[model samples]
Structure formats: C-alpha cells, structure tokens
Target: MSIEVGSKVQGKVTGITNFGAFVELPEGSTGLVHISEVADNYVKDINEHLKVGDQVEVKVINVEKDGKIGLSIKKAKETQQPQRPRHNGPRNNRNDQRNQNKTESFEQKMNRFLKDSEDRLSSLKRNTESKRGGRGARRG
Candidate 1:
C-alpha cells in the first residue's frame, strides 16, 4: 500500500537509533518517527518507547519528493482523543509578565533590571565574603 500524508497506518518498528525509529510500513516502505514525534512529552531516548519488531500506529505527517516519509506516533494517538485544555501554568504566568513588560517604557525596564542586578550582585558578594571569613581575615 502506498503511503500518503495524513494517513494513519500500522507498521512494524524495524530499527531504532538515537534520533528516531524506523518503521516498516506495508509493502516494505520505511518511514521515520522523529524523537519529538514519538510522544507528546519529552522523549530523551527512543529505545525506552520502542524496540525492533514492535507494532505501532503512526500518522504520516509528510512525504518528501525524495521518498522520505515523516511519521508521528503522537499525532495518531491525538486523533483518538479530544483536544486537551491548556494549563495556566508557569509558562503562561511568564508570558503574562512579558506582556506587562511590553507596556513599560524602555528606560523604566532598564532601570528595573539594573536595580535587580545590583541587588543580586550585592547579595552574592555578602555570601562569598562571609564564607571566606570576611574580607580582612588573615589566611593561615
């Protein structure tokens, strides 16, 4: 069977590498499931998720003119589930802070940054000096 973009197909994992896993689709065609595409979360190691001869359902994300195919196991799984609501997590809070910063004048932002930097530097110096028995302590 010919592989087409956006098609979900069943394939056997033929090989695994640091970057991705190669799957043998029907008719002996091979495609790569990139490490990032293997899962919704971070995939540090492909071996932990797949092994040779494992059967997997993959979505064909792209097909290059040179016969290379890009597949995603996560996309295939996503199709079966309803869309998830985004969490108002730390990332969103940081984005809100960034939006607030955008409204501030350049000079104001620079002054705030400088003040914060000076505070941090002074605190670091105090900690280091205390650890070394204060600046005037004689070394023995």
Candidate 2:
C-alpha cells in the first residue's frame, strides 16, 4: 500500500535514534518520526516514549521525492479541544493588538528590549561596584 500525506497508519517501530524513531509501514516502507513530533509536550529523549517492536499509529506528514517519509505520532491522535486560529499576518489593526499582548510592532519591541537591557546593565553595575568596594577604594 502506498502511503500518502495526512493519512494515519499503523506501523511497528524498527529502530530508535537520538533524533527520531524509524517505523516500518505497510508494504515494507519505512518512515521517520522526528523527536519533536513524537509527543504533544517536549520530548528530550525518544527512548522514554518509544522502543523497538512497539506498534504505533502515525500520520504521514510528508512524502519526499527522495523516498523519505516524515511521520508525526502526535498528529495521529485526535484532539477534542478547538484549535486557535493562527495569526500569520502583521498586526497593524487595533483589534489584533487588543486581542494579543504580543502583537507589538518591530520598533515597539526593539524599544522595550533596549529599555530592559539598560535596566539590567545598570543593576549589574551597581551590584558589582558595591562588591568591589566602590569607585574610590584605597589599595593597601
């Protein structure tokens, strides 16, 4: 059977790696499930979530022209919660800014970052100067 993108299929884990796990799909085809796509949360170690000979349902994310199939285990499982709409465009309107606090423009974000960095630098200088006996300490 040919594997298509966005289709869920059952497969057996044939091997495991630091980055991902290899699964043998139908018709003897093998696909790789990346470490990040193995679970919903952060997956530091793939071995903690999967092992050899384990059967898992994975969704085919991509079928490359080079015969490489990218699979995702998390996408195969159904979620009851509604997905939030992604904001890909620039948030220039008032409604977009009001809806999300992170919708600041490039200049606004740069100003905020500069102010925070200056504050941190001043605080660090104050602490370090006091520890080193201030500016006019006598050398004995």
Candidate 3:
C-alpha cells in the first residue's frame, strides 16, 4: 500500500529495540517508528508498551523520495475532545458575567492576602528547626 503523510494504516510490529519499533506495512513495506512517536505523552520506554508481532494503527508522517517512510503512533490517535455544538442564540447569561466581576473589592483581597502571608511566614519559621549551621560571614 502506498504510504502518504496523514494516512492511517495498520502494520505489524516486526522488531523491537531500545530506541524504536520497526513496523512492516502492507505490501511488505517497512518504516521506523521513533520512541517519541510511540505515545501521546512522554515515552520513557518503548518495549514496555509494544512487543514484536503486535499489530498497530499508525499515521504516516513522512515519505521521503528515497522511499523511507516515517511513522507516528501518537498522531494516529486524535486527542481532541469532540467539539461541542454552539447555541443558536445570544449569550445573555448576565449571572455569569456579574459573578466574574469581583464580588470582593481590591482592598478586601489585599487584606486577606497579607493575613495569609503572615500565617505562611509563621508556619515556615516553626517547621524549619533543622538546627543547621550557616556559612561563616563573607568578606568583601
């Protein structure tokens, strides 16, 4: 099968190494799937996730003129949540907008912040009783 970028295709995992997995596409064509492309998140280890003989759906990322195809497993899965349908009327939710307008005045917020800061300082002072020595006074 001809592989093109963005094409989703099924292939068999032929080999597994520390770095990547070799996938044999239909028609006996093969491509290298880098470790980064193995998952949607950080792929710390590829072998733990895939083994030889496992069939996988992968997206073709690149097809070079020299016939080297780069594949990605992460791109094969669409991560986006399905889009929500828009309401067909004006957004007259005055309650939400009014609540967004700060009910607490700036002065009240500042007072609360300063009081919290004092409590945090006292807590830090009480907890840090390691009794460690400090470096000697430095000279200019």
Q: After superposition, how far is residue 67 of candidate 3 from its true place, in Å?
A: 1.6
Q: Residue-wise lDDT of candidate 3 within 15-117, one digit each (tens)?
A: 9888889999988999989999997567788978899999999889999889988998877875434434444344534344445757878887688679979
TM-score per candidate:
0.65, 0.63, 0.56
Cα lDDT tens digits, model 1, 1-140, are 67999999999999999999999999889999999999877899888999999999999999999999999999999979986755558876757777888979989988978997999899999888878889955577
CA lDDT of each candidate? 0.91, 0.87, 0.80
How many residue pairs collide in each prediction?
0, 0, 0
Quote model 2's TM-score: 0.63
Clashing pairs in 3: none
Ranking by TM-score: 1, 2, 3
Candidates sorted by lDDT, best first: 1, 2, 3
CA deviation > 4 Å runs, candidate 1: 86-89, 95-140
Q: What is the lDDT of residue 78 in candidate 1?
A: 95
Between candidates 1 and 2, the one scoring higher on TM-score is 1
* Regions of candidate 2 where Cα sits further than 4 Å from its true position: 78-114, 117-140
Candidate 2 lDDT, 40-139, residue by residue in tens: 7789989999999999999999999999999999888745345565454564353465557577788887886799799989999888887798885556
